[model samples]
Target: MKRFDEIDEHNYSSDLIDEMFKLITPEAQAKTHYRMGLAAKIDDALKAKGWKNQDLAKALNIKSSSLVSKWLSGTHNFTVDTLVLIQMALGIQLLDVGEEDKPNATSPDNGNTPNAPVELAKNIDAIKQSLTSVANSNQKSFATINYK
Candidate 1:
């Protein structure tokens, strides 16, 4: 059988898939991005610690490396407890709750207020940090990045 790449471009078109992707809700897209971002963070942490899927599986106390593979594939529906376990094992924060130095305040909206757009920008920055921390792993120290 011919490989997919060997097929003539004229024989197929990506319009259907493209349109389907376009139909996806922004919320769904954001969820996918965050899931993939978390996966990348875990993969980077494993590499930095000179570990493999088996090592992580052992650390996580799972019998199957395939489970780790699924997590790395960015499709795992990770639970908060599982995330905490992974964070503990890897010594990295998979989710950024807020600024460490800042005091916590109880918002009336529980943070989803009239200033939600501003808060969203900050949340995006936190996501960026998780996604890019591996690139800066070699640095001795770095300043905290604030998105204003």
Candidate 2:
């Protein structure tokens, strides 16, 4: 007979356990989501500035750009210090609580602001175009970026 330590605890297949382990806990998952969102914002900012990963790494004072890549990968856990450093380097906000969670903020006019989403979408589209233009122009731009 196999000892308890030698047997699978929950009778789950090894592959299944491996897959489950690949995913983080719910809290960490939430954090990953937040990090990914920040990464996307940073990506946009980088494009807007026409800066490369090496430029960002230099701004972060990291000798290697791999560190920046890891920070952007979303799977890496970010420390408060790292986040602050990124914010300082990029001059951007990474974790501001927006109007959605504001205690006094409302949708205005009995939640009848139906155009707000459209406006936001339009603004996002504009920003995308701006970034693309910067990228296409091959301009050596630099701006604030944050990893936190």
User: Evaluated with TM-score, which candidate comes out highest?
Assistant: 1
Q: Over the stretch 46-124, how does candidate 2's per-residue lDDT look in tens digits?
A: 7778888899998877899988787778676778788777777777766545654343222234333432445456778
CA shift of 125, model 2, Å: 39
Task: Tally clashes: model 2.
Answer: 2
For residue 1, model 2's alpha carbon misses the true position, in angstroms, by 38
Candidate 1 per-residue lDDT, tens place, 1-148, comes to 5679897978765789889988987567656766787898899999999999999999989999899999999888899999999999999988657664443232234334422345566788898998788668735344455447
For candidate 2, list the clashing residue pairs, or say none. 90-144, 90-145
Per-residue lDDT, model 1, residue 138, is 38
| Alpha-carbon RMSD, each predicted model | 17.6, 23.2
